[model samples]
Target: MATPNTAATPTFMVFATLRDDTDFAEFAALREDEQKQLEVLRSQGRIGAHYVSPARRATFVEVVAADEAEVAETLATLPFARFFDAEVYPTTPPDPAEIAHRARA
Candidate 1:
């Protein structure tokens, strides 16, 4: 499987919560389409990981893009996107040296 080269571009963590007024039936109806689009993004190396918390009605996705606007543009393609209140956060891997120092402290 192809993966995004995180060294070449920025990575973002998108946290999207389903609006309280969202219709569960409508969300379910659009699930298949949403999955298809997600698969496409994954194949294109635009997405790294996708996780959901059904109990909390929230989703967390790792996105690879140049900026937050690009991340939003990528997510906007999802069928259920209109129902989401999304926040995009820039992310970086933890520094290994810091981790080692902390471990020894």
Candidate 2:
């Protein structure tokens, strides 16, 4: 089964990995700033979901936006933008059964 996509609401998936030259001190300093920014986005109903990778060093975020430019603008607000390499993918919901089958495989 194919999942439906709404033209009015576009979804984006962000995968962020720590850069080799990331400075821990600067990263720590920006944590509070990023958290505050995320809170504002959340309040605005922009963020769909967010999670840290199992390894604890990476982050994955799902956002709702009008277009790619909006997604890029939102991501640019993150304080750690310079410290991470990020990939942004346009996404849609997947079938639950297919996801379960993949898990079983």
Top TM-score model: 1
Candidate 2: the clashing residue pairs are none
Instruction: Return the TM-score for each candidate structure.
Output: 0.81, 0.76
lDDT by residue for model 2 over 1-105, one digit each (tens)?
111223345678889898888889988988999999898776665665899874867999877677778877778877877887889999875457534633443
Q: In candidate 1, what residue range of length 10 has the lowest lDDT sum?
A: 96-105
- Report model 2's TM-score to 2 decimal places: 0.76
Q: lDDT per prediction?
A: 0.80, 0.73
Tell me how far the alpha carbon of residue 45 in candidate 2 is from the true structure, in angstroms, after superposition. Answer: 1.7
Off by over 4 Å in 2: 1-7, 54-56, 93-105
